[model samples]
Target: MKITILGTGGGARAHTAKLVELGHEVFVGTRDPEATLARTAPDIMGNAPYKEWLADRPAVTLMPFGAAAAAADELVINGIDGHNAVAALSAIGDSLAGKTLIDYAVPYIYQHESEHPWPTPWGVMPKLDPCDTDSLGERIQRALPGTRVVKSFVTQEQTTVVDPKAIGAGDHTMFVAGDHDDAKLQACELLRSYGWTDILDLGPLVCARGMEMYAHMHSAIGFGLNQGFGGHFGIKVVR
Candidate 1:
């Protein structure tokens, strides 16, 4: 499978590495290849810089956003920032048509630093932008008419996403939702390949709300455990 992942952050690197490890051809899509290669900021989950991550995976090709999508043969994974997704993907134009788009973007608004602290309980919770109205998945689906948009892994951090067992979390179920059945099936295979054992098929792309909103609750739980932005835990549901 020829996979193109959009973004050069932790999520993108994690997905790209796992897919490549699974024997799939993967390319990374970024706004600017030069800047992407020079990026030194830590990812949302506090992983090392993109340049550092890329150093380990020399086999992966990094290209401009549109070129990556245009080169995709099997899947296109949305690993970019939620707010930038529509514009970035829109720039790709019709290149995404007929591809299974696994969207993991989350549109969120952080509270002002003055309004909140940086520690647990109060200051640690994250706020989402489109709650009860829309989701990144629905917006992307609308942006690209013919693309099959499926949302998954919005609830997990990069490590948990690529390796569900990494956090010692047991049976923490991964949820996937999309309007197209075949697309979801293909995504499920990819998820399974990345070592996700327990997955739930939540129907329809609109259900992305629940998955996206899980971000807030997931953070709360993380902070509660003193794992603020640490990406060291996951949730497992019983029955």
Candidate 2:
């Protein structure tokens, strides 16, 4: 399986590494590959440099967005921020046709503000645009009509996404939703490959409304724990 993942952030690093371990041919997409590799500072989560993340996994290739998507065989993982998702996919154009695009992006921190006074326990939540009614995944699906869009991995931290055991998260439901049956099945298999035990299939792309909106609940719990990103474990659906 040839997989192209877009983003240089934590999620991208985690996804790329795990996919590589699964023996998938992996390519990482970034706005500027050279600049990304040249980065020396820690990321927002205080993770090591991007180039450092690659040192252990040299098999993973880094390239600009266009080429990475063009090279993808099985799926394209959107690990970039949701605010720029459409633009990034738009840049890829026809290369995404007939492909399963697994979207893991959420509203970027700054874009969380809107007229809505969406309240959370910690504070008054910023209005997340395209949420409640639509979602980042839906936007990508609409923009790239030829692609099979699956919304997934948006609620988990990068650490939790790859290693659920990192925070002792066990037998938890990882919610995934999309309109395409085959693509959704492929995503479920991908999750199982990475050791996800409980997967909640939430139906169509429109169901992404809940997935993306869960960020508030995630934040409240993380803050309550007072452990920051490492302490943040996502939703555990109990039946």
Candidate 3:
């Protein structure tokens, strides 16, 4: 399978490496391939520069957003940062038409003034926009009407998302929600490929609100466990 992941951040790197390991042709989309390759310093999350990371993964191809999206066989994972994802992806709408877009972005507003701020190890916790009523998944679906959008992979760290067995022997649950049943199935197939044993279909794009809203709880759980950010954990749904 030829898969396109539209981001150069840490989370995107996790998916890229895992997909390549799974023997899938992976094309990573960035704003500018040259600029991304030119970075010398680590990203905001302190992950190594994109060039340094890609050097170790020779099988992964890096291209501008549109070209990468067009190269995908049918699946495209939107790993673009939540805030900039809609605009970035909207620019490449044509390339993504008729594809199953499994979006895992949470619409985070990184810089905001709050009377009661939620601070974390990484700084003030980012606030979610279009949060309570709408979600990033729905926004992406609206932006790309030709695409089948599925909301998933947002409730866990990207590392855990790609390697569920890293925690609890993959006993925890994964969730997928989308208006298009076929698209949700595509997402579940990828999740299974990632070794997810228990997947719950949350039903409809609107349900993305709850998934996105769970970001705070995810962080809280990490902090409660003394693991800070990028905590290795998973949430299980007990029947």
Candidate 4:
């Protein structure tokens, strides 16, 4: 499968690593190509020598955001922030008319610094914006009338996203909510390749409202649990 990851954050890198591990062709698209490349250069050099040594690697592509969406095959995961989701979508919304976009944004309207502790248990789990009554992923879905938008993987830490071995520490579940059965299955296959053995399909896209809220709660768990950096959650099903 040809995949395009449209962000430069850790989540983007995690997806890239997992997809490449699955032997699929992956293209990374970012807004700030040069800056993202600089930040990832050292890590790529140390961890992904093959990708780094690829003859056609672009480190970052310079296309407009809309162009990036047009270039993808069947999947699009929004690894960017909730605040930027609409703008990013606007850039590529038209081109993504008939594709399945796997949305992964938590619309936290507020955040904190070390000095200013948040009232909530998780600083990352701030109150969302007024307009985010439903959820940004849902909003993205509503905005793109034709695109099949599925929400998933918004309830965990960045470090645990691609490493399934780390799931033994009580962090390995990835939550998904979408309207399309086929799109969810395709995403499940991608998740399987990323070492995610367990997934919770929380029904349709409306369920994303609950999933996003839970992800907000996880922000504080990381700090309080002392899991510090690599914490995540997964379900162990018994037959």
Q: Which candidate is the best by TM-score?
A: 3
Candidate 2 structure, TM-score to reference:
0.89
Candidate 3 regions off by >4 Å? none
Residue 45 deviation, candidate 4, in Å? 20
TM-score of every model? 0.89, 0.89, 0.98, 0.77
lDDT of 2: 0.83
Q: Candidate 2: where are CA atoms >4 Å away?
A: 109-127, 167-169
lDDT of 3 by residue, 70-117 (tens): 999999999998999999999999999999999999899987999999
Residues 1-239 of candidate 1 have per-residue lDDT tens digits of 88999997777877898888899889889889997677677765577877888788888999999899989996999988887888888878688989999999888655645355545544544466778888888989999988999999898887678888776644688899999999999999988888888889989999999999888777777767877564577777678
lDDT of each: 0.84, 0.83, 0.94, 0.68
lDDT of 3 at 10: 88
* Winner of 2 and 3 under TM-score: 3
Arranged by lDDT, best first? 3, 1, 2, 4
- Candidate 1's displacement at residue 195, Å, is 1.8
**Model 3 weakest lDDT span, ten residues long:** 228-237
Give the total clashing residue pairs for model 3.
0
Total residue pair clashes for candidate 1: 0
Tens digits of lDDT, candidate 2, 129-164: 676777888888889999999998888887688877
Please state the error at residue 32 of candidate 3 in Å.
Answer: 0.6
Please give, for residues 20-138, the per-residue lDDT of candidate 4 as tens digits: 76766776666755554355344521443223433344443434456677777888777777778877786677888888888777776665344544554333435664233687877
Which regions of candidate 4 fall more than 4 Å away from where they truly are? 32-63, 111-125, 130-132, 169-172, 228-239
